[model samples]
Target: MSHNGVQTESQRTALVVVAHHRTDSLTAHIGRRTVAQLEAAGYRIDFLDLHAEGFDPRMNIEDQPDWGNREKPYSDEAQAHMQRVLAADIVVAVFPVYWMSVPAVLKGWIDRVWNYGFAYGRSKPRLAGKRMLWLGLGGIAGDDAALPAMQEALDGQLNAGIAYYCGFSHSMVGLLPDAEERPQRLDAAGNLNIGDAISGIERDDHYVEFDRKAAGFVEEFLAADRVPA
Candidate 1:
């Protein structure tokens, strides 16, 4: 297990799944920041840009759940994506919160790639030991009273529903709130109040902090694999 008197595991690889339609969006920026940090930490990054790669989020007849056969070969694209997922030690999905869950594209990717026999349904799951991080950015204000409820819903869906069911060893759901300061905010009476745009200085500060927060979560993920019982 040791090489040159140093212990090593498999060459660390991360499949970073980003679900954003625009490259200029804050969601994309978060994904980029995540990649930079992981690469700097010695991980070979497999960046899965669902939109940029033209991954279909729809489930055709060929992709329906098959309780009988887990190994039915799906579309070449799904199979190929599954291979990339298998090649990585960890998976980090960076996305904007959509209806308190993943975007359609990312959801579709999972529906197809993590199909039965592949991610689950076998006596022994194929994806039992890998780790995962669901990093989501939302436009809701960070201090909004509803943030906790949103986080809880996401935790149950992504962590409990998907990762746990798929047999991942560990999964972390890190929510980045206040990702967007919208152009308007509702008042106590629910009246829309036009909001001023963030000044250049404030915008710069916010993103710098956002980058730090993103890196912090990634670092925590990397450290966890080293902790001893």
Candidate 2:
């Protein structure tokens, strides 16, 4: 169906799932900026603000018993969310690192959304051939010592747990970290000077051009065809 004037058939659809509890934080900024770039690139964007949408992180009481059950019943909303995940060619998860891992909301989103018979447990994954990006933000520096545990956790949790479990190739999993440390010059309203961050990372620009370039590489990787294994 064509929603928001976006053709679901012809145009490539990208779902940007932002899981930041705080709207005014750096996590939100990165989510918004990435969406802007993807939208500008002509991809149909579905900006899913999990917090704003009031998505209950905890599964419903009735559904709790079906945690690992293969025959679990999904509510209409849950079904729709899964459909969206299955429909998209690319899924972008944006959030902040909390305690060296994703915030509870994002983790819960995965727990509830990626269910049995959908994300895994069959001969193949339901979301196979799809791609994903794990875009993260945190106050910690990007040095090896500062983020060793975080990196390992992300690789295990996101890379192994979600992406690989769902049969998405390793090339499809991209990570962008330390968003808060990026040099940025923006007003109180988050109005960033486009040229500054887009110029160069070492430059006095407002945004982090290097980060953007890295994100672009991920986007391009997602759009590439999967080779036979």
Every model's TM-score:
0.90, 0.75
Name the Cα RMSD for model 2.
7.4
Per-residue lDDT of 1-229 in model 1, one digit per residue for the tens?
0112222475688889999999999899889888888877777788889999999988887777777877788788778988998888899999999867888889999998898878889778789899999999977677666679889999999899999999998999998876875543446686755566686889889878887888888888889966863
* Lowest lDDT 10-residue stretch of candidate 1: 1-10
Please give me the total number of clashing residue pairs in predicted model 2.
Answer: 1
lDDT of 2 by residue, 77-188 (tens): 6777888888787788887777667888888777778877668777867888777888766545444354666677777888887788778755233445435433333454
C-alpha lDDT score of every prediction, in listed order: 0.83, 0.69
Clashing pairs in 2: 197-207
Runs in model 2 lying further than 4 Å from the true structure: 1-8, 65-71, 170-220, 223-229
Query: What lDDT score is found at residue 143 in candidate 1?
Result: 66
Q: What's the residue-level lDDT of 162 in candidate 1? A: 95
Error of model 2, residue 131, in angstroms:
0.6
Q: Pick by lDDT: which candidate is best?
A: 1
